[model samples]
Target: MADTILVLAWLVLAHLAADFILQSASIAAAKSGHGSRALAGLFAHGWIVAAVVVPVGFAFGERGWWFVLLTGLSHIAIDRAKVVLTRRAAAAALREAHDRHEAPRPPEHLGRAWTPQPAALFLADQGAHLAAASGGWAVLLAGVPLDPGWTAAIDGWLGSWDRVAVHGVASAAVVLIGLAIVNIRAASLFVGILVRPVEVTAGGEHRWGGRVAPAPDPDIRSSTSAAQAPVGRRWSIRLGPLDARVIAEPEPAIASPASPSTPPLGGSARVGSTIGVLERILIVVFVLTGTDVAIGFVVAAKTLARFRLLDDRDFAEYYLLGTLASVAIAIVSALIGRAALGALLA
Candidate 1:
């Protein structure tokens, strides 16, 4: 049973790494497009998945190759299904909006107070992939023994380390690595989808607190020439089931004086994402080591760094929603890791 669990963990870790870490942004975007580019992306992604899975399969023995074949094919099939479903849903949405005489919003920007269609689709896609992985494990690899040569090599490499201690360490490492990947890459994608930026017309009415509200900032119109100025924007921060707030967008690039020190938009987003990854990693470490209270310090320090920006209700709500989501995911991942570690070590 223990060996089965370890093998299952390796399979899951391989899947997560390939899907989120190894797959580049360009490849991910290309996969959603049409024709030859999409096929190329899918093939590239398949190779990546194979790269991660093949080594693990070989480590377990020849029979494990069957697991590799099952998992890899299922991944591609699931992804293709997701693409077809998303495109069909989008076309349907456009037709509905046309019939109602309403402007069609992109799927990513569909819902103001609820989960966006893109986010829901993303979750479903991932859920399907994971289910496939789990099902493959049960069918072909559930009772298979690890290769004797591989086990001997691991033991020899560890030298004088006690066997029980080595097993404990291996289990802990697997759990920690899996948790880190999910908390960092996967959570970033999820939160970004949920809190995507919204565009509105300058000085036009927009939804706020379940009602239409006029733009509050009178000086926004004079910030720049019409060509340079962006339309008004709002970020809907859903605080809870019954509570949501719309915050004004940050000053447009045209309004801010450009400096060599300023990062480009993409660079800025990358930096923010890096910070989020580090923050979640620290929280996971704190929770795993029985220093959960230290997680508070992590949150406090992050909030302090952006203290001045918090004065803007818009930025504050956006920041709060993101931070809360990050912290929640990290904490939950840590608790699960701790439980798995305890059970394995026992």
Candidate 2:
């Protein structure tokens, strides 16, 4: 049973390591295009799964390469599905937007900005990978083949409880720590990029979150110029769901020469990053200590902090999504760590 649990952990660890840590920006960009590069990245993920499962199979006493084969094949299928579905959805959105481009629509449609595609696709991709992993776990639990020799290696990796006290370290302990760090560091980047609004700039090109893109040729008229009627000439584009028109809103005019004006972008990057790390830490600590109710206090505190700003539905949704994502990541890490620690202690 302990071995079974370990196998499950290994699958999850491998999934995280491969999907987030190992995947490069170039690969992710390529995967978005649904081209040969997408296939290549998908294949790369399969190899990663195979490498992890093979050695674990040896230790977990699984005979032959059935585990590897089963896991790798399933992982490939899931990844391919993720790639295809995301691409298709995006393409369909483009087509729809083209049809609606000429239609009269209001500027700054608050409700449209909150449509969750990029975020949803991301979550769905991860969920499918996890489900595939569960299938592999089920197979292992059924008792395929085991090499008892693998126990020594497994034991070494987990480390003994007393030895950990003296040495101030344990393999499983370190793995958990790394997992928490990676979740905050890398996963945040993914979420940030996904949720970040793509603003249609003056040149009709998209920029992330603001009107900071290089000014297009001042003499050249963009097709979007006509669409700027609602928000004056100075405005920013906030993109909506797949194929949805960009929402333009007027940038606030400066009140006075002496008064500092707020940039439409809003929020301090450094401060937000700091808050994210702190929240993840708080969630993990609260979960492991068995004071889960404290998690609610944390949530309430965050809500109260932002309650004054809820009038802006777009910003509110962004805050809400980010908060939920942070809490979810912490909860998952804490639960996995707790389980692994228990088995190691037992």
Candidate 3:
């Protein structure tokens, strides 16, 4: 029992530390606020690690908590290696510039400033998991346990065949850990939305970085922007791919009490409806299984809703909804498979 507690402690600490370090590295490399992207990337990478660890853990006896602890530490190490390599490459770019006597040009800004591709995020996530796993294995060697099951499992990894229990608590542990990482990434994205926007002056023009402040209550716009309407109204709702329009309405003496300052794209009620649909899909998938199509539907719906790509808040919300939606589809797919089997048996 004492050993079990130690192993659990190691898991939590390793997860927290790896998450922080990987995110920091991502921020440094991306040269922008992609914190949420980093979180999602880390979660995706952890799943890749689990692919190896799950089989290995099953081969080894499921008794010792050491296996999991080691995997977590190794994950940390892999991430660190990736980060180090990335920095070195970036530095080399600067070194070449310096050698030529030309000013070391800052890294060129890529296609989109705020947007990041999903695949990059996934790769970053894998790096993080690798680092953690590396670190974890080192720790495990220091206080190893004896178990006949584990010995057999390691042999299996060495190409020996073994009839280890493939579908059981051990498998569930891997799935649950993956789910937890996804959840953490989603939660982190949600929090990143709340960070304050920075003000900057460049090229003799002033602009807000990251996000624009919420527009004043529509009703108070008469007093606030008496001569001109608020600026964000241009992107309030896009009529087409490029065209935008301002939505005007009579200003009430007092705005609705429930409306938050940053009215979150849609009103509160619409947001709730979107959130409900996402949660339903997740619950269904968890109970069932393998519902990628349904999950894809949810992902598409949320992405479309992101038409209001006016600020970082909208971007974060879009990804959060997508994450939940994908999970739901997976659960639904699994449920479908089970039902098919039941019918065949009948």
Candidate 4:
């Protein structure tokens, strides 16, 4: 049972590391595009998936190699399916909009509308890959004894350390690493989707400036009758395949002189993402160490740095939503890790 748990943990760790950490942004983008480049990127990512799992396979013996081969192929197949499905879904959405005589905006133009199809598809894709990993392990490796030679080598290397102790340590490490990966990378993707803003235009007015509070007001219709009228252009915020919310057009922003050109957003976005990653990591550490009270200091420091920006209602909402989500993910991951470590060591 211990061996099975350890091997499964390693399998999950490898999958997460390959899919999230090692896969380059360019490769991920290319995989979602057309032509031979897409195929090349897909294959490259598949190779990485296999490579990361090779150590586990090698340790497990000959059957492990076969497991590695099947996992790699399955990953490529799953990703290809996601790409095709996403394209078809996008096309169908555009067709539906055209049939209604509405001007169709591209998905990107939606500016991360709440629960967008792409984000749903991304979550589904990852879920499929993880399912494959767990299912493959159950089918191929469960109940099979660990390779004796591998165990003997590890024992020899550790000298006086008991094999069980080593396995416990290894399992703990794998669990912690997996939690860190999910808290940092996976949570970022999730929080971004959750905080996505849907743009609403009405009555042929295309005013597109100013940030609105993320939370929709229940009394918005009464408060802004002209803007909230049913007549005019509107878009649906999707929850998976369904339209979760249909926001009415909003009041126009007061026109002012065009502000000076700002720097490209790409750099700032990258910096913010990096900060978020660090913040989550620190939060996880605090939780695991039973220093939960220290988490307040971390949040305060982050908020203080962005205190001036928080004056903007839009920025404040975005910042608050993202911070809460990050903290939640970190806490949950840490708790899971703590439980797993306790089980392993006990």
Candidate 5:
């Protein structure tokens, strides 16, 4: 039983190492949908998972082969299914958006509005992977045989069970740290790209980018591009001549709240990205302490805090979905942590 748990735990660690640590941004983005690019990403990821399994499995003898094949093939199958499904869903969404308006253009000009739910799909993909790992563990427990003398070797190799655990814990901690540092940043960027608002031209071509944010360089009037900017607002560059004076918005008699139609409330994506980092950290805390239910409170608080936007069904769904995505990512990360911890203590 201990060997079963040990092998399974290490497999989870390997999965995280491969999926989150080794996979690159280009692969992640390309693999979100079914295409040649997506196939390439899936194959590359499957191979990486198998490669990680090869060295780790050496500790398990013949059973290692069964574990490797099961987990690696399952990884490929899950990812391939996800790519096909996600791409289909995204295309359907784009089609629905197109159908809404006879002529598609900017969201401001066209009556149609549609954006891919990359955030949700990405979260679902991760949750599926974790679930698959769990399934593989169950398979090992039910069928695969552990080496009868493995415990003797483990004890002899490490000097004692306590020492074995200590070494395991240290190794696991290194992997977990790599997970936290690499996965969070990479996941954030991947989801950011996936969910970025895309504009589809009437000609059936998809285009990236949206309202460009105010550049950090304050000297906006210096560039040839500054001619298109307006004078007063933060988003506006100094468009006037060299001697022209600048004026700010006059203080109103009564301060009004920012409207839904107004520009993004925060100045830049920095605030949103920071919030994501914090969300994942809290999730790690909750998972490690076995306080998963508190995650519900986090979600509830966000929903209530944005109660004003509840009337806008579209906006509400977007906010709720994004929150759920964050929760899902955290849950996966926490599960990986638990697996690593188990390897250490088992």
Candidate 6:
């Protein structure tokens, strides 16, 4: 039974490693200006997980194999679940934005078919988890003892029953981390809204509305030279910036609240201001996490700046502060993950 579990775990780990790296790479690719280094690094993370598990499998023999397999499955399952949930949320948000006439121009490649980056990323994540679950189970079922008498070789490190406990803990930690990330993201969004207001006008009236932010630099529009024109309008077609309706409204009261009391964090924050704060936070977090923060940062800045969230120079400063906060959070998250893993395993 132990050997079977061990083999399964190793297989799952292998599948998960491949899936995560590929998913991360895909996400990095879809966003603009994410450097090759960042992309390569994301693609490399799976290798680290793989490296740690392979040797353990070899050392503990059957038991070790089962441990690795089970742990791997757990990792994959948690990640996959998170991806599914996140994707659903992102898709809903995108649909709402589109319906409300607030959707950004989809990059040329996306046209009407393009889904949000988060949805794509989540799908990739789900793929990795699915591979781990099915592949790991298959490998274990195929061979009774992944290695006959393999459990005796290294009684030193894992020491029998400890292997199962360790793996159980590790798997749990992975799931917890996924849950934490989702929560943090949601909390960050709420916090952002509490601090700023976006100025959205519907027709001629001021309608303060928050929007689904876009990436700062999206895949640029495709070159017209390569675009195949539709059959009918070839000669008489004129391509130019479409005329946007202009409306004038009274200058919104720029004055601070009379009592100078700041609202509680994340509640009733104005749309433009909220985006500004959110972008600043994300920029800082991205730098610290060394993750490719998406074009949401750029959109937030542009929208907020357009609505007078901050003057140009002040916006720059706000982003700088946001970076610092993100770095701190990244460190804390890492530490918490490490501790959580240790506790679960121990």
Q: Give the TM-score of candidate 1.
A: 0.67
Question: Following a full C-alpha superposition, what root-mean-square deviation does model 6 have from the true structure?
Answer: 15.8
Which of the two, 5 or 6, has more TM-score? 5
Which scores greater on lDDT, model 1 or model 3? 1
Q: In model 5, state the lDDT of residue 187.
A: 57
Model 5: per-residue Cα lDDT at residue 172: 68
- Among these predictions, the greatest lDDT belongs to 4
RMSD of each: 13.1, 10.7, 16.5, 12.8, 11.4, 15.8
* Superposition TM-score, candidate 4 onto the true structure: 0.67
Q: Estimate each model's TM-score.
A: 0.67, 0.64, 0.32, 0.67, 0.57, 0.32
Better by TM-score, candidate 3 or 1: 1
Please say which candidate is ahead in lDDT: 3 or 4: 4
Note the Cα lDDT for every prediction shown: 0.65, 0.57, 0.38, 0.67, 0.56, 0.40
Considering lDDT, where higher is better, how would the candidates rank from best to worst?
4, 1, 2, 5, 6, 3
Better of 1 and 2 by lDDT: 1
Per-residue accuracy of model 5 over 33-113 as CA lDDT, tens digit each: 335766787788888888887843554566666767777788888877765665555455545544453233322121132
Candidate 1 deviant stretches above 4 angstroms: 59-63, 86-115, 147-162, 197-271, 307-313
User: Which wins on lDDT, candidate 4 or candidate 5?
Assistant: 4
**Cα TM-score of candidate 5:** 0.57
User: What residue pairs are clashing in model 1?
Assistant: none
lDDT of 1 at 158: 87
Report the CA-based lDDT of candidate 5 relative to the real structure: 0.56
